[model samples]
Target: MLASPLIEFIAREHPAFVHVPLGLVAALPLAILISFLTKHARPLTGTAFFIAAVGWASSVASLVSGLLWGRQVNLIPVTGYFPVVASEKQVLQKMLQLHITASLVGFVIGGLCTWLLWRAWRREDSPGFAERRHAGRRFWERGAGVPALVVALLWLGSWGFSGKLGGIMVFGNEETNKAAADADRAKRNDAEADLPIRALDYASLEPAGAAPERSKAHGDRWRRIWVTASGIDDYQAGKPMKPGAYAVMATFTDEKGKPGTEPGPLYMKETKADGSTAFLFYWARVPENLRKEVGGQDSVYWRSPDPKLITCLGCHEKDATPAK
Candidate 1:
């Protein structure tokens, strides 16, 4: 889901907002340790409670903003709690999964620690608290103080680890940088990359018709034709596309005898300098029910000279055709 501008701004500020809770939580262990040694334990215990409560509360904002930021970056799926780490090569995704897990664990631990402190604070402030014989004992040995301290330490450790992972993600590590560069090089070497790009952005060309029309030769799908400036007049006149010009046909699956909301494959034909035609068929996302049409693949990209495009060449033997 797309977030509002205000929410997007908050998500972008996640790095800044996280420091508030982290700083508070980092100081919590010190305050609790001091409370154990102080003669005036009640005041120090109250201060510890205040710090825990505020830190746990502020963590909510940090968690929410982090989730939003993760979605914005596509590291986490829109509806997923964790990113899919399918292989060892997915270094960044693996790090993100660990980071999210650590943050959640810390948040839960912090909540329990805060509650413990709150209970301890209430007992220390009770009217009969001074009269009790246990009141003379050290704060760590009394009530929930020691347990809260232990849990607080665990919380700190989890958040500290999570923060380390977050840092690596923001500032790429050796492994991450190398993986990114390799991926970029692979993409550049991929031959279908530019063809898929042009097919996806076919709308930038001039439209041959105001609305889509059903194409009987193209599986009865609704298709709208778009042509380059050099080929628009010729395409409208049923003449062959001139050299260096191309035409794209954007298709939609049928729905109740009309164009469905689901997008179908994009078909493109370009006339080369040698006067030969090149064809491209691209579908970024194929509907599940229609995956069989493309050999069960969820997406497809085929260009001229590939045996896969023989069907396209068979139909447009000479030039682009208007949808029937």
Candidate 2:
């Protein structure tokens, strides 16, 4: 389902018109045939006319709706993924463009059909309207009916096929993609079980000058994440991680040129050997004064040990098993 209002409207309405063009195509022929059998069959001609008019109206509706719908769906998402099946995509695009051409063709055919039906009707009351009008009216009727029907069929068929291909994009990959995701996840799980979970040593920094070296190396990658920063956390990886939770905060330049900030914290309850959870907390933040603070402050801002805290599930929960 399209969340965007414009897309939603197009998606909803295209189907509505899909049937209209086809229905009118079906009704138009019946209308012309009945009119020829008896020019006085005003009811037949009127019904056909109504069908032709509505059919053409709906056909136009489908054409416009499809175009708008296509625009919204064809947008690039910015993620660096290549488009699959480029040629096929282009082919489908051409078909949609052709849908518009077909629509105009339908309009012309319907107009000419309606005009000929009227001409046939006018000959009805002219007592001898029959003899002189028969040949010309038959020709016009067949002429208008065949091509109009073809236009509707070809146009609607193309739109329908294009719609199916688009649908396959969002919802059709489920069977194959889901299976692949499941298989990859299973392999990862098997590997994590054999991997060693290393613990971070946050206690030592100044004596070894490891802090400055690490600080210079990573810069402000992790904001305000120093080992002795106000609120701190420690984790041991080889063993089940300590039951802990932490908030990762960072400063971002906002639209007004002033620094804006958002806090994203991850909470974790360590699992015991028996698989039970022990809840503990570790909150992280880069104080406003420490704007230039490097590796010891922000998550992703710095990358040294003292200023780093394992993110929930990101690092702490990564590599739980051995390699395949």
Highest TM-score among the candidates is held by which one?
1
lDDT of 1 by residue, 22-106 (tens): 9999999999988767666678888999998999999899899988898778676555568876457778889999999999999
Q: After superposition, how far is residue 168 of candidate 2 from its true place, in Å?
A: 10
RMSD of each: 11.9, 15.1
Report lDDT (Cα) of residue 308, candidate 2.
26
The list of candidate 1 runs beyond 4 A from truth reads 1-3, 133-135, 142-144, 194-251, 255-324
**Model 2 lDDT per residue over 172-254, tens place:** 46654554577577658853222212112233221212222111212222222222221132322223333232212222323
| Residue ranges of candidate 2 with Cα displaced over 4 Å | 1-7, 38-40, 75-89, 125-324
Cα shift from native, residue 209, model 2 (Å):
38
| lDDT scores in order | 0.83, 0.42
- Residue 140 in candidate 2, Cα distance off native in Å: 7.5
Top-scoring candidate (lDDT): 1
Alpha-carbon shift of residue 167 in model 1 (angstroms): 0.6
Model 2, CA-based lDDT: 0.42
